[model samples]
Target chain A: MSTVVLLTLTGLGLAALYFLVASGLALVFGLADVLNFAHGLFLSVGAYGTWWASGNLPGAGASGWGFVLAVIFGVVCGTVVAALVELVLIRPLYSRTIEQVLVTVGLSLAGVALLQASWGADPRTYPRPQWTQELTEVAGARVPNDRFLLIGAAVIVLAGLLAFLKFTRIGLVIRAGVEDRSMVTALGIDVRRAFTLVFAIGGAAAALAGALGGVYAGSISPTGGSSLLIFGFIVVVIGGMGSVVGAAYAAVAVGLLQQFVNYTSPGLGDICVVALLAIVLLIRPQGITGKVATS
Target chain B: MLRIEGLSAWHGEAQVLRDVDLFVERGEVVTLCGRNGAGKTTLLRCVMGLHGNQTGAVHLDGDDITARKVHQRARRGLGWVPDDRGAYATLTVAEHLTLPPVVGPAPWSLEQVHEAFPALYTRRASPATKLSGGEQQMLALARVLRMGATVLLCDEPTEGLSPLLVQQVGEILRRAKALGVTVLLVEQNIHFATTVADRHYLLAEGRIVGHFDNTDIHSREADLLAHLGI
Candidate 1:
């Protein structure tokens, strides 16, 4: 019972991390119509940026404040990378939806190679800064403070994203664009600008998730990013592709379920995630949340 | 004003339009009338630069827009409200007005659109997908008016509206004409054409077969009916 409870909390915590990273990916694909294979690569970039900034700016007024600086740096790096990709690559591929994937896939491969070249292909740690190293007891269960912090941060991001999408002009335009790009453009707003902004926002969110996940898990690597990317893809598919709330729910469900299966059969744990995704897809071809309403 | 000359377009070589030539002066509410499959919609799409495979010289106030993108043409004062109204199915009526990119300051506002179509004001918060056909059409026109367009291309605006609402929509077109916005209207309803159009072009099999200006439609009713297959 204790094992299930502890592992479940761990799974949920990690699920929170996945939600933070993957929802942005799902949003970009659903709205911008970009395959964005480089999404996970951006997360890796965020983790590495955080690691570099924290070490270089060690005098960040204290460990927590240093952690804050690292996050800000990660977001900045990711946003810049995203905007550049949009301006340089994605903006040209609007009419050719099929080739959009080809370009992004090539980019993702290049990104992975770039990371390997820069960081030597080995796992690197974010050091679990002293402030987060301490453990805590919550509701009689022992939990790592950093994991809890990760969970809290994930929740906050989720809420903030929901509010932004629901209330903002850009968010409303994005929702409409997903329905009819021609109509949105005909209204005289440059849809190209919206696509670029969406990409940047998605990249920034995923970067933060990458930074947080690296610290929570204690390491990150070029190859390590592939697994997170695949997991995010699975979550998006099962939760309903392009659905922010759906991604969150699916992530938690898959995370906990995968962890439970891991206890029973570590090999099957991976299989379980794939199997669950397949089942969901077969039952709801549009995904669990189904197609974006585009309202 | 809008003008097209030697405009040719195709749907992968099936050729929907052939050297089509037409024009609409400012404040003109012109109708392109034809039976089913006469390329009326194709001509409109070509003028709007929406047909993927196309060749044409489309001019707006004497500016050549032959190769302009749809959005570029739109930004240059052209607005198209598709037959379907292109409702953002999940969006509210209020969102419908706000989501499209507005080109400039317009005489119309949310309040004016609401006043023009009071039924919309009553259901401003309702999902667009859930609105009645007439209500949907109203919201569609209202949405475009909010976008500050000088030229409006409305395809089959009254296709599915009630008779009374159809009359009301004609009034709306008259109102748009008074605002000096040029309109290229395509319709199947002869009564609608007779009531609203300043000029009429009868099309048959992707070709213009007959024409009648405002002062002359009465004399050419037979030719119009024969060409229109009405």
Candidate 2:
């Protein structure tokens, strides 16, 4: 049925965004053991960056170019913010888990306040690309072009990330560092560089999600960061805290569940996600795909 | 070449290494022999810059590395194979060898390392957690060798390994010395150390109590064992 196609498409689109955000959180935690509480703020900052770029830059208001430019600018800005946070706050707190949590939470609150002060509390709308606004008919089902674009982008990012992890030297070290930092350092690896690189990449991924959400949903609000943060955390917990593949699968599952719940009763969507998270925890304390840590 | 002068390390308030002075010339295999709580591990950590509250000077190739970080010390040709083996659960045996930045000239290639330690070739794709204790030890040693460390600081490299693997480890160290690599190892096994080392320092209660060359090691074995209470 057309309804099934619509639900699947929409669910996949939403899952892509969730994967982006959750994967960033997972990677940062995996590498540095720094549970970045300020991660959600990166999303809002990125959304705002895109808004500023599209509005201020000349010729950026045109179709595909505008959205693409906005996303690029947003990702860069978000990376800068995350790099600064790492330098100023994260580096010193590497051995102190409680301190890292406290400091990052404070940073997130400050980020939200800064955004409110600069952009005001009003919700801002982001214009979808002209090309993406048109609906396409596929197998007698109507779907927006941007939905397909979102899914394509997700696949590309996932493939690119996997290839990088599997083939590149830095990626190998990052993967190694995630499991045993001291060993990586012993091998003469500059693990700080690895941590920094992962943190920056995580920030960029989160920012990309923000930009994607802004384009597809057409709105950026002050509470956007916290809301996305909750969703990301839920996905991570369900997927396994440090597994990217697990996050992707979990995100899609959550997205589909949310869409189904929304179709039945809008109020029950979030409740369903929480219930699913609880069930996953109860069944596999280590999350769906997580192996019990050995060392 | 490696030197430790007036090295004193502390775990919080209690000092573990007291004015520990030691040296290993290029192409020599030196073992710091001691029992448990003798500050052998702490001395190696201080050299690696892992112990922050240490007041000491570690020199590598006549350069003061006392102030350097762990990674910096490593980059300066100090390779550490800690007792824990630094095995990462996520990385496979092949990745462990490839992950560290290759340093120095004419280091062992992957094929060469596989040939040197045949047990690793079969488990090249196995994660660290899946590998047996002996396999992990071999992987750890292989990693440092592949990284081309001129001075290898191995902390209990043969601990918890089978006797066969221990003999293999001894052979590996002998081969390393023949290739002109310097080794500073902490060992509880005197038999293994005697097979590999040119000189030995007996450590007790965080200080260097005695030193002996290989020629005198046999004569000093009983005295050393008494000091080690073996």
Candidate 3:
């Protein structure tokens, strides 16, 4: 019914965050070959950074540009953390995939702990501001106006990102690097610089995702990123790891599927979705989208 | 234009290359002809300075390039088209041609390379993975030419090309020699060496075993084959 349609729409609206976070992680993993477990921590930090900037900053960003200010702050904090992590940790373990996996996992845990201490364990509310409370009728159901904004924002962000990756110089280098690290470097590209930029970009996108997630969920806990991490992993797995477009498509499909489960079984909806994903893995080991093009 | 002295490389104590002494002057097409496991590719890699534990003195343009990064050497006019062709699967032939960071470029463009080898122009927009072996080799060559380097280290440039395409490659090399490009071509094709290379340095068990000029290689075919273990 109309409720199910609303739920599906809600899922689509949320797919924006998934696309942002997963695409960045996919690039990092694909290009740098780093399995970054600490990626989710950037989300929580981005959420907190947005909160601090929009909620506490002086009259500078307190006006109608609160949302934009929050997003910018999130991007900055995300990028800084990414650079720090790369310089301090990832640089040492470059090309050591197994060590990278272990270190990133440990770093991730440490990041969660750091967020818990900095922002506290209790969840924090992030209201979508007064202007965003407007309602719209979707399939005869009243939908929050902010949800429409979320959907629009996601589309805009994704389109802009796609354009950047397609048309820009660094973007072309990045895509090329993912295909063959050796060949790209041999062509006079500094692989290290590209790797750092890729990680920073991923961090920025994760931060943006956090900001969007704050508006959508109404509150974000310190551990908010953990669930996101899980969801991203599932989407990446199902979509075929290292594929940007595949992650986008898989996010929508998984989001809709999750919404359907919520409708079918309210209490065990999460479990139902997990079971469905398990079934998917059993059938398609390469995931729903299959492998990316190798060099 | 290039020199390596007492260069030794180890893949974590395996010691793949030992005291490898090699040199190539400007505008020279020298071949690192060698037997299997003779470290021909390793010598090319050493010149590129692509390994961390590689101990050597690599000099280019009369400067010690031993400490420089791989890309730095590349920018200093060392272009390497690896044996793998390095064909980025998703990238189009046009993108591959356009992506290399070309400096001081009074050289060929994609149009010119395509004019030289028309097959590339035909598949200009095609994904590189979809290209046939011959076309892929052409793409790699075109991509390197687009980089506008003075020296090219082509590791097995004619590995999997058809005979007709191989003939075309020999013509390309002849044209390249005319263009004043120094080619350190690592080739297995005897015909290619006889056709295009001015000099040959055969290697065995990671050391230079024999040297030959174009005429020496043609007349001493048995010695060349025996030295290369072909």
Against the true structure, what is model 1's DockQ?
0.59
Which is the leading candidate under lDDT?
2
lDDT of 1 by residue, A207-252 (tens): 8888888878788887666678888888888877677888888889
Clashes of 2: 0
lDDT of 2 by residue, B20-139 (tens): 899999999999988799999998888888777888788888999887878888888888888988887777888888788877775789888999999889898888769988888888
The DockQ of predicted model 3 stands at 0.52
Higher-ranked by TM-score: 2 or 3 = 3
TM-score of each: 0.94, 0.88, 0.90
Cα misplacement distance, residue A282 of candidate 1 (Å):
2.1
Which regions of candidate 3 are displaced past 4 Å?
Answer: A60-64, A87-89, A98-103, A131-135, A267-295, B11-13, B51-53, B227-230
* Candidate 2 residue-wise lDDT, A1-295, digit = tens: 8888888899899898888898888878777888888999888878888888888876666357776887788889999888888988899888899999999999999988888999888889886788787899877889987788778877877777877877888888777776677767877778888777787888988888888888788889877987888889888888887777778888899989998889879879889999999999999877777731111
Q: First chain TM-score in every candidate?
A: 0.93, 0.95, 0.90
In model 3, how large is the Cα lDDT of residue A156?
73
lDDT of each: 0.81, 0.84, 0.79
Which of candidates 1 and 2 is the stronger one according to DockQ?
1
- Evaluation by TM-score, superior candidate among 1 and 2: 1
